[model samples]
Target: MTIGQWYNEAHRALRTASTAMGRSRALAAADINAAVIARSAIYTQLARATALLVGGSPAAEAPDRARATAILARHGQSLTQLYVGLQAAAVVERQFPASPATAVAGPARSLRRAVDAVGVIGDILASHVPPGQTPRTPEGLAVRAGGGVQSGLADIARLTSAAIMIDIALPGWLDQRRGHLTEIYRPAAEAARWTANSRLSAVARELIALGRGQPRLHGLDVARPPLNPAPPVSTADDAVAAVSAARTWMWQNPSELTSVHLQLGTQLGLAVHVLSSTGDPTMIGGWRQAAIAAADLRATSPVGPARDTAAELTEVLRWLRSIGKGNHGEPAGRHLQQVSRLNSELPIMAATLHKGLSAALQRRDLFVKDEGVLQRPAGSLVFRAAERWRPAMRDDDVVQDLVRALVQGQDADSRSEHRSPSSRAFPLPPRPRTPVSGAHWAGFDPPSGPAVRRSR
Candidate 1:
């Protein structure tokens, strides 16, 4: 049976035993049986948990087991509770003085307390089960305690011939949270870093440190090799969202351009493109929405910078969508050109962004001012954010290939439509509004580069 089914059945048995207090001998006997089922079922789960944590039989993967072991060895005191619970349960079975309905309530209560201890340990270990391995904790993950409601988790440490065994480990809520693997934590981390906002960066680091087994949310030391990638917990979509935010900021302050801002935008765009190509749902979900949001945020803003930024981002999003879907006809050629241009410039912008981030790390010039992390130089936050979006101009040949393939696919589709001939009756697509290119090395470039340090 599935582990869930097994767990449910066992839980029902415990509930039956716990509530059996009618003064009859029959009710007392039934309670004992129910308690036995509960104990056996839970002990089984505990065994499975130990196997998972210590890498015992059934799917002995080395790395995961080792990691689990280290976590347990370093901070696993929950086992003591498990042992105490088992001892309590053994006492319940060894003496049935309270087996009569008149005394059943007291016995049931003791049985429940022991069961609860084991259950909590189960949950604690569950929390640490690598998010990837939770699907396999049932099946042979079975065992039981005698009489009713519980068993000794001590079975894991057999005692015989004067030899005591305590090899396996199971983690409990030992120290503070050493690490975490969750859905939202990763994206939150990436967004924190790219903004360079002292607050966000600090939050991101805490999340990063959690993965490395430091749960206090403090140590996000970005190592100097290969660009400390957004923490592994981070999905590609988080990275996309980060870029989209950067792009929107640029749109709001087109007049302000800096190497960091420009390079960031370019790299963000490139990261999105590369990630989308992978088709992994986590990386691709909500991507188109992110593009649309960047445009909408700007479109609703004020007159000069707001509307202007809106217009620019809207055009970029439009191009991104059209290219992705392989939209055809006259616009296809221009879209191809835009894609080609962005591609060529991608590398130069990437190099610039890398250099900027590296320099920021070395110079210790990340965003933050007043003694409190919240305090910053007047207007620097927005000004800095705006500058981060306008990347230097360049081109890429890889995009040319992607665009060419798309154009070819569009061509094939056009032929398919023409051969059918019902296509002419359809309304023509609206002409695209010209993109309001950002002010950079391109046109209205502003004071940028190395000045963020002075802000610090």
Candidate 2:
């Protein structure tokens, strides 16, 4: 072949190789997204299935899949929001056919919608952040300005893993609803974590490289995480003491309770994780028992208002107790409104536990001799847990800004008509229509005062 022909062939080959590499990366990105979507679908389905089994109707016709795609394209979107929306839908769906233990269902949905709307708006506004605003990676995504690289990735890794485990084991978990989730899902969850890690491989690498000021970064980089990771369970008595202080702070700031509860649930979850990692039969058994108790508490029918938070707090408390209560810590937080049966006794109980845990560390140990004593290793766990346990609640300034921004951002701000989903710029699942009351079904007023009532 002539030199001209050879030169053309080499150029074409180089182009082909470059295109192939880009194609591979694109495919990996797609796979990560697919995994997330798959997980969300399973979550949504499980909720629907559970609702059906419990005599609840489907929340809303699952939006036409094609239509949903079109809607998503027209509006700004995020994987996290989409997943969260599906989760919210499933949770709301499950909460319907309200049992004795749930919140008074009717009026609360608007609040939930508003919360979701705020979250979605956060994603949307985040998208609009000017490129010049913050330090952007080569791929042009913001980095979490704060913490250790592994922590953020680890958060995604752990959360994604936990979700995957739940998705995988959900059917079984429901089928044997009485079984402890720790028993049913823990092992599978640990394994699923690696799977989540694998999915996040690309994102994690980008984060690491960025932290090190590497020149190479890509278009698909995830957003920067906060400086500190989401808090974990405190293992130290001192750390536990800090948690108590945080609770006291939260109590004074009642508005912060919801965030506290979310944090507590997370800490309790992480505590179980740390405990389980120890692998001792006793610790594992404690974790299992705690898990079972938690599952049982939440499984009770009629998970009314405080009962939900109560159940969650109780789960945390039970685990703490199982671990020998090296430090007195109470499971009080934002989500915990007054638990119904407590008759406002929870604070007293917490105070009492606080006093009990304050005693000599060895004395607190029901464990043999020094066996229960939290030594250097336990100290690290405690400090890490305490540091991580601090709630990321931004109730006042953060929430206010978000609410104002979303409202002002609405296309329907001036319109009297109700806003459509598209106007909000998020793809939140439809709120379930309120179940009509019996009075509405009868379509007639009951006899009123002065016995001027209708004849029976």
Candidate 3:
């Protein structure tokens, strides 16, 4: 079923539970059985929705996917609390048979409130569902629901605490439910951080190499080194700090260097902004400042290689800024944006550097000939070095491949947009098929389905 369908089913089941719990008196055996069946139905639908949302299949847009996952989490937690309240009610009926009326009132009241809380969550989910979809609810129903559900949840919390006083085991069940959600989201979070750090470290190393090599080749005396050794990167924050430090180093120790060096510094600064500014509006100012700095550098640079390099840098920065302004509403989208920028800009930067280095080497070789030197040609050494660094900077196909993989995982429709026509002519290798068993589902383990495989 589509995620929308599953969510609809969950809402229907929640309504059934609410109806069954309408009576203020203690729940009879039939009422309890109905509630249990409804709970099981809701659980199944919620699990299906979550699996579909996070699975390999292309689902909704990134913003919709994020909202759907949050709805699933909130409803799942509410369902758990509802079931706990039901169980506590049953315990109260069994423990105080003499005054069952008063004993069950507290639990029944809490169960009713819990059902209302679940209804409120369903309203929120319904708000995001597209119009004309099956099993739709009134649009903007959540706002009309008075937004008091948060306070209702606090009341439920107090009631659950009272139940806890009566049933010592209640906390264990709540903890188990919380732990299930933690386990599901933790791996995805860690994987995202690891991917960001890896990309950041790679770019930092490239920039450092360019900074050190360019000055020596041009025979320019350095006032200060362009960059120090890259700091150890164990986290995304550490990677950001390292990239920021590189930018600071470049700015603090300004020297006469090639336009390629300036381009690399501009790219590095932009990378810092993209990595660190996931959702912050203030970071846009920093990104614009970096662009302005590059423009200023370009204005002062001489004609020839410097002018050409600055022009390329300007185009790259403009493209990157356009991407930054796009509707990348999630952190995953921001990461993919970073990858896309790198894949597009790296080859141009490398070519510019290679051209400048080659020209410098040719000039040196001519000077050597005019002086009647008997040493080996400088072209040999420079070409050898170029050959080594050329593949690292020029061969951007590896980065393209990474971007393809990431786009596949995040948004499959964007794959075509990331690749050029020539690159698209060559297909990527097929990925291995892996079975997604019930064990892989985050909160609830539903029945297993067919294996999922990804290919280009």
Candidate 4:
């Protein structure tokens, strides 16, 4: 079948699955199994369709591709919500098995069909690749081959991260939830674990094959060492701690913030490309809002490192907008190189931000009422700090100033004589004074400091 034909097939399958899911919602107690099955089908089809569309050929008609991409994104989000709902239902059902015997038959049949449909879609995409395609020049060949290797490595990293989340992180999180594990859910949970492990192993082998097939690109393989290590952050506390550590590191190593911003720009540019490809207005609007938020952060920031970081963020957002408008070539390639250089740090930083956001949302009490005001600015600061601490940019003055200000602010807030309206409005939380390289400060101070300024 042609790529367009396959897209039609995917569309039809997705529609059928979505209809089933919708009908399942109104199903009686005995048919809850059917509802779960329908939801699984919907999730599978949406995921498959979205994946295929993302990797779709550039030759496909723009309008059709755009429409399909929009559908996939819209359905993808809905199916994710449904999947979450299914998980919640599973918890409820585990305690009181509403027709346990009914679970295996209907769900098994529905899932089999869904899996077969996905396999067919994958096969079609895989077979549709043009044969005998080779780069015209050695440089072109290297670029093509090196991109494959980088993509393969990225896939491996993503898959490994997902596997870790499924195996270690998820179970740990589930343990925290009440009534998460019951005898009825054990079989399904075990099956999911087995399936995830099997898939991970298969994907890993494929990624290794992909990497091996690509010719060695000399410059690409030479990775610069990281300035500082980024430990994995799984929880809110861990994310907050990582942010703190990153802040201290950046303060001591201010020059590194520029490199951090460059890396961030690359990542954001890539995201813009992906979102633009989807042609979904809502998604594009959300991206624009993020850019606007960055701009606002830049406008409101003080004349120090915070403003500098915000300005860098705004510049990146503008670059990303340009990339979306098809103004990419050498500049995009340069951005990609920056990403490659900071490959080790980028994932950790992304993960930390994701976790931190999730933590903030889940525990509102941990953040102030207007947490949105601080989120981007604080994040920029942390990113700048982290990048500075990284070996690529080893300057620490920016981060040191941040630490000094934080420490001084806290101290000033403590002294009644020094309290001011501005400080009162945005009071620094009290923290124990600790010295950063003989300079006294509060909380997690960097290893060293320059001249300390007393807060009025």
The model with the greatest TM-score is 1
lDDT (Cα, 0-100) at 386 in candidate 3: 18
Instruction: Return the TM-score for candidate 3, rounded to 2 decimals.
Output: 0.17
**lDDT, model 1:** 0.29
Residue-wise lDDT of candidate 3 within 43-79, one digit each (tens)? Answer: 2222222222122112222222234334333432443
Candidate 4 residue 362 Cα shift, in angstroms, is 12
| Per-residue lDDT of model 2, residues 410-453, tens digit only | 11121312222111111111211331111011211112222111
Q: Give TM per candidate.
A: 0.21, 0.18, 0.17, 0.19
Task: Indicate whether candidate 2 or candidate 3 has the larger lDDT.
Answer: 3
Off by over 4 Å in 1: 1-27, 55-104, 130-388, 391-456
lDDT of 3: 0.29
TM-score of 2: 0.18
Residues 1-456 of candidate 1 have per-residue lDDT tens digits of: 212233344344344433432222222433443333333334444444444334333323322222333323333344432332222222212222223434444324434544554454445334323324522111101111011011112222221000110001001101113343222123322221222221212222332333342111011011111112222212222222322333334422334433334323443344334423222232222222222212211111235433333344334444455555655554433444334323322222232222232223223333311222233468666422222221111121221222222222222222332211111111111111332232222221113321111211
Model 3, stretches more than 4 Å misplaced?
1-34, 53-456
> How accurate locally, in lDDT, is each candidate?
0.29, 0.28, 0.29, 0.32
**Residue 178 lDDT, candidate 3, scale 0-100:** 52
Q: Candidate 2: RMSD over Cα atoms?
A: 28.2
lDDT preference between candidates 1 and 2, better one: 1
